[model samples]
Target: MISLIKLSEEAFTLYRDQILAIEKASFPSPWGARAFLEEARNPVSYLWALRKGEHILGYICFWMFAGEVHLLNIAIHPQHRRQGLGTALLKKMKSFALSQAIEKIYLEVRPSNVAARRFYTKAGFQERGRRKRYYTDTGEDAIVMSLELLDRSESCAERCGAAGVTFSTSEAQKDLEVSKKRIDLPF
Candidate 1:
């Protein structure tokens, strides 16, 4: 019963508390409501919330730039983890990226977050590289991942690999209006 919807300033106040609650519940060092508010007002940013009826269960944020989208944050409430909410949110993100004409999508996840890594792996994202001491609070390394634009119209799992890599197949592949691109950011 999870649905994805664009988040805007008008609906910011309504979901602020819920978003914060999920952030705190999911992350060791959580972002506050004010931080989320600031990002919502950023022109380069887009936010989406996973909601069940009136309750927000999780959220994703990204920055769009020059035909690419960089995932900023994605968090699901601890109580609702492993219910496919994250996957649904990522699918929505890919749809949005394709719609925006983005050919590359990227994200950074803590190296220790095996579940998230596996989730992304199954969603056609591949590990490309690593950033040393990327998490300032914990001094933890981050694994960079990206998804390449495919000619296929469906989601597909990517082969395991390192970063700064590219995969392309040009055999009469149909262009899809998806909103996700595999991406990586150097830390």
Candidate 2:
């Protein structure tokens, strides 16, 4: 069974090493342990690890800012690739974002990463744009993708309510049922 845990100080050294290994394997210029340590100290960012027993399968870092969550990095250990762990990590992150009142989520992935692109697409992220030569390490472009939470009001109603926004799951469901009735009833 796979489990996801928030990175803690006690796990810092191990998380750093695990993340670095996956980073080095996935990118031409991987962020080292120091960079990760810095990010881990930031209050606006969240870091998590996917683990199986004593082994870490992957890590993700995302920054929440101005009502949006920016996925800074996500890397799965080479040996763990193609196991759907990445999708699970992203789903958990999206749930986190919704719970935090984030209205949108964005990420930049290397354009050359076809597998990653397909995975993101399947996870409801739509390619919105691209940055030319965004990755200086390899002079490769980065594809920007985003998921809009506004369209997922039902999935996010709880957080919206906690934020005092007055959104409710029942209201959303009622709206959906009304819409379905409208469609079925025709003009």
Candidate 3:
């Protein structure tokens, strides 16, 4: 069985090798241990892993602040691609954002990465803009994409009422849900 779990500094340390293996395999300019280590230490940054027992098949790293999410990195092991894992991870993040009343999510993909762009488009993220020379490795331009999670035109009361809960921004900091069957745990 697979589950999603929040990664802590210790978790990152423990899974460094496995995560790094996927990282290096999935990207052209992969992040090294130092980058994950830094995210583990950063207060606003969050890392979530898709785990099957002790092995991490995939993971996502992002930053949340000011009612917005900036997805920094996401990757799945080569063997695990095309199995809906990427979409699952993205959906998990979207749900988390909605739970926190986050308004939008922003991410960047290399213009040359058609697969990623297609995936994001299928997931409801629209092309918003472009950044010049966003990829330092190959000087490739990056296409910015964004997903609007909330209808800000509506009041909090209306939105929260529809969900049968009072609007409370404090819940944004509430822990991720957990269940033994398939839980999202925070360490």
**Candidate that would win on TM-score:** 3
TM-score of 1: 0.77
Evaluated at residue 41, the lDDT of candidate 2 is: 78
Q: Which ten-residue region of model 1 has the weakest summed lDDT?
A: 164-173
Clashes of each: 21, 0, 0
lDDT of 2 by residue, 14-117 (tens): 45576677889987789888778777778888877776656678888999989999999898899988776777677667766766777899999988789889
How high is each candidate's TM-score? 0.77, 0.76, 0.80
Q: Residue 150 deviation, candidate 1, in Å?
A: 2.1
Model 2 misplaced stretches (Cα beyond 4 Å): 151-187
**Pairwise lDDT winner, candidates 1 and 3:** 3
Comparing 1 with 3 on TM-score, the higher-scoring candidate is: 3
lDDT of 1 by residue, 70-134 (tens): 99899988888777667767766676577567788899999888888898899789999999999
Regions more than 4 Å wrong, model 3: 151-187
> Ten-residue segment with the worst summed lDDT in candidate 2?
178-187
Per-residue error for 128 in candidate 3, Å, reads 0.6
lDDT of each: 0.71, 0.70, 0.76
